[model samples]
Target: MDVFRLHFDIDGGSFASAGNASVEVKKTLRQLGVSNAVIRRCSIAMYEGEINMVIHADGGTADVEVYPDRIVMVLEDHGPGIPDVELAMKEGYSTATEQIHNMGFGAGMGLPNMKRSSDDLKIETKVGVGTKITMVVRL
Candidate 1:
């Protein structure tokens, strides 16, 4: 199949619409006859990224590319960049405020889950600048 690309702008502070992009992507994948396993991994990974963008950044952008052999996702945010990527990647470690925690989110599982779901993951960030995460899942 030819490559397909999707772009989404995530709205920060909008819990009600946090996962809308992922849901739409899931629907698109379903319409394209993507496998269940692929859809599940992509949706969960995208959802986690979406949540991160909303909680940390004021807003952000997500791009998904569906290729014949793999799916590529790029999430970019202008949030306070991760101070310590190694620490952030550790399970149960988070900088999320209590307000976010009360929302039943920000349990520090986002990066870990993204890593687990994607075949390849890359994270780039700078303090006070922003963060960019790229993930790839093989089909």
Candidate 2:
């Protein structure tokens, strides 16, 4: 199959609309006959990334490329960059505000869940700049 590409503009701080991109991607994958397991992984990872963008970054962009043997997701944001990647990787470590916690998010599982769900994950960030996350799942 030819490579399929999908793009979405994630709105920051919009709890109500979070995960829309992941949902759309899941639907597209289903229409393309992707396995449920793979779809679930992609959806979970993408949803986590989307939530991170909403919670941390003001907004961002998500891009997905679907190939015959794999799917790649790239999430980019222009928010404050993560200061400590190692610390952020740890489960249950978060810097979110109490307001965010009240909304049922900011549990510090976003990055961990992304890593657990993706076959390969890469994170790039700079202090005071932004962050970019790329994840790949093999078919």
RMSD in angstroms between candidate 2 and the native structure over all alpha carbons = 0.7
Residue 75 in model 2: shift from native, Å?
0.2
* Residue range 11-91, candidate 1, lDDT tens digits: 987989999999998999899888999999999999999999998888799999999899999999999999999999998
What tens digits encode model 2's per-residue C-alpha lDDT throughout 1-139? 6899999999996889998999999999999999999999999999999999999998899999999899999999999999999999999999999999998888999999999999999999998899999999999
Weakest 10 consecutive residues, lDDT, candidate 1?
91-100
Q: Candidate 2: which stretches are off by over 4 Å?
A: none
Q: Cα RMSD (Å) per model?
A: 0.8, 0.7
Local distance difference test, candidate 2: 0.96
In model 1, state the lDDT of residue 88.
95
Q: Give the TM-score of candidate 2.
A: 0.98
TM-score of each: 0.97, 0.98
Q: Name the regions of candidate 1 deviating beyond 4 angstroms.
A: none
Q: Provide the global lDDT of candidate 1 against the true structure.
A: 0.93
